[model samples]
Target: MAAVRDSSFERQAPEADAEELARRHLVQPWPYAGSIGSEARGLIGSGDGIYVTDGEGRRLIDGPAGMWCVNAGHRREELAGVMYEQAMRLSYNTPWYTMNEPSAVLAERIAAHAPGDLSHVFFTTGGSSAVESALRFMQFYNNVRGWPEKKLLLSRGGAYHGSTYLSASLNGRPRDRDWMDVADGLVVKLSSPDPFRRPEGMTVEAFADQLVDEFAETVARIGADKIGAFVGEPVQASGGVIVPPPGYLPRIREICRDNDILYVSDEVVTGFGRLGEIFASQDVFGIDPDIITFAKGVTSGYFPLGGMLVSERLLADLRRSNHPDAMYAHGLTYTSHPVGCAVALANLDLLEGGILDHARAVAPYFQERLKTLEELPLVGEVRGVGLMACVECVADRESNDPLKLDYEVGKRIDAHCHSLGLLVRPLIHMCVMSPPLIISRSQIDDMVAILREGISRTMDDLATEGVWQG
Candidate 1:
């Protein structure tokens, strides 16, 4: 009977059992290879504005803006038409020597919106490649232009740059590096700006000082001559929504400048109005990075196009030194992918047109709604800006001790919200929210209401199970 049931299950397939086996057995588990862990997770068939419809017909709100990429909502018809037209017109092109019109247009618009003299644009296939491109350029800039001995890159302890060999090495979180089991020897990690888990009474200002001193000491230990660049996500996304101190970025920028190292800002999550600014660094921190890598919102995750906005310094060095014979030796095969570029251009137009204004106007209201969660017994901290926010859970108020043994608290909250049709993600000890820029007050209220219910239900479940006697 068991063998017969197994045979029937195996016979069922969407395309075919062979195709299902191909994904489940042969493939490296799609984008995140280890997420599903020896099997497939949930399958999504389609998504509307702020909700995703799964293969099983379950509708869930997209809480993390599609992994913090889709600034615009899903199922955008205009973007769809643009992609279709772009595919029909010019499908592919070599952006190296022969540039295409879509790429040129997108570049011009991006440069204009990007902060400061971040004027030159270099294309990559996605965020990982974009970050990798920036890191490699840092090395190349040091070797070709000056300071070949400077090859070490410094990043915060909880940064999530990307997943490529070089980029992931730059990430500071233990989770991202957990299974990897080794550092690539070119990166350095320092204290993050998070005060939640740091030393007691540590003011945000003190945290900034600590970060600078930590970097300075690391530079001294490595002998600054071996350091090429100091890279960071200005608003620390995957590192538990860690926001820098009031003067954090400026202080870090100063430290990097003092040591004669390039400063690279990984704006994959903070760029394109996520922080209510085109670029979070220049707008909020008053710092000028040598290079800026951006993705996600560049195309709203519509077609996987990302790029770095290079400064005049690097561009000039590349132009003067990179002769016809010189390799310059970088670039993905899909660099400036034509169809992707067109979709990105359309995405940008929507962002600048009205979506950005909406995000800015409603951000404070959203912040207010999030702050309302502080009344919940489980919520220890609610911190965020613009459209990105987080609710940290704790068992105690003073120590901020997390309910780590069982995600029952966080899981209950997640499941309750999921059951209510609101999607939420539990990262370590927090519930992170990064809704699309197009979200309305009503949608925001609905999400917050579900969150309130989720917290209450989680507490009730915990109390019922003898985990929370209070």
Candidate 2:
């Protein structure tokens, strides 16, 4: 490999360790591995505000918010110190038959802070359990309503709820369903309410109308009387952070109401200040879901914790049904784990302070920086809200079609950024971003600078391979 004129090179050996591990041990790692993001090595450490230090002393700004879960950033001493205190005193207690102080306190905080009739909180170890609990509640609600036939659930076209069987099926992703068949029955996919992907000459209103029509068709096919629930993210994070068009959420709310389906918001990623709102569903979209799944920011990712917000009607039905006595048959061993709850409470206190408001205030500035990516060569679309953002890479600007570089091109760009000390997470063909809410203007510029360099070189590198065309 002598010097090739004007040819930018990308090192492949760096991610070989990750590939080997995947080939030898793991089976599924969606939006993280495979041809998309496997080249970057996995890390074991992080810091406050805007950086993650790998075990090997590699540092990069985590723009994707720790799988879009960590809104409060990592390595916050408050979250850590509180957890230590809790671990010293009453670290574990069963939420099932027994309760703990921290868990009760955290539940009160969640209920008070949560929107709408979401006054009841059921803690889970993580987002997966929260989503699973939401699904179970759908069936239970239908049974309680005396309509067991309404078992079908509808989800958005590309939302990522979780990875467990029920949650995966509830999600709207092709990659997630590649191996697992829909054995769970009645999980229907509907067109998402994305403004960017709207059909030609269609207004956001019309596109949303089409989306509602698709849901109506699904319900018709399944019979509205048989539909149980409709679940989706307010911003559709895992699906390239496709922010739904204006009036889209209200329309979906209408559709759910028209058909009498429970509306579930998978806010596992958009909850907290990620969207500059407490919950994207209510603050951004102006619609409140019957139930919402939450994790990541709830505990600031200090300890694994996710929970489901329940409405009054649902809670009353459950209480009236004697569901606890009947054993609804759901819960994790670490459900309402005391340490996680304590950290969550501490994290909540930290988030509730003016820091969240500061993040919200500067959201427009962060969004402006993200939009600057449009001037780059390979970058096509920049979608974001609050601190969350995404840049969809494309080979040609005219059609907005993907380069189909798959893993190779994405890894090269990501590695190039890493080498420059900026960390970015590539999801599918799009680069996702969710830097900690505490990120400053300078760090945002730093992150964007590296990304610009990486994207600029990707075109040059791909051209050398004769794969990219105008």
What is the lDDT of every predicted structure here? 0.81, 0.78
For candidate 2, write residues 22-76 as lDDT tens digits: 5565555544444543333364454656688765678788877677766777777
lDDT score for residue 70 of model 1: 80
- Candidate closest to the true structure, highest lDDT: 1
User: Candidate 2, which segments miss by more than 4 Å at Cα?
Assistant: 1-40, 320-325, 405-408
Quote the positional error of residue 148 for candidate 2 in Å: 1.5
lDDT by residue (243-280, candidate 1, tens digit) is 77788788778878887888899898999889877788
Which residue pairs come into collision in candidate 1? Answer: none
Report the Cα lDDT for residue 425, model 1. 74
Instruction: Identify the candidate with maximal TM-score.
Output: 1
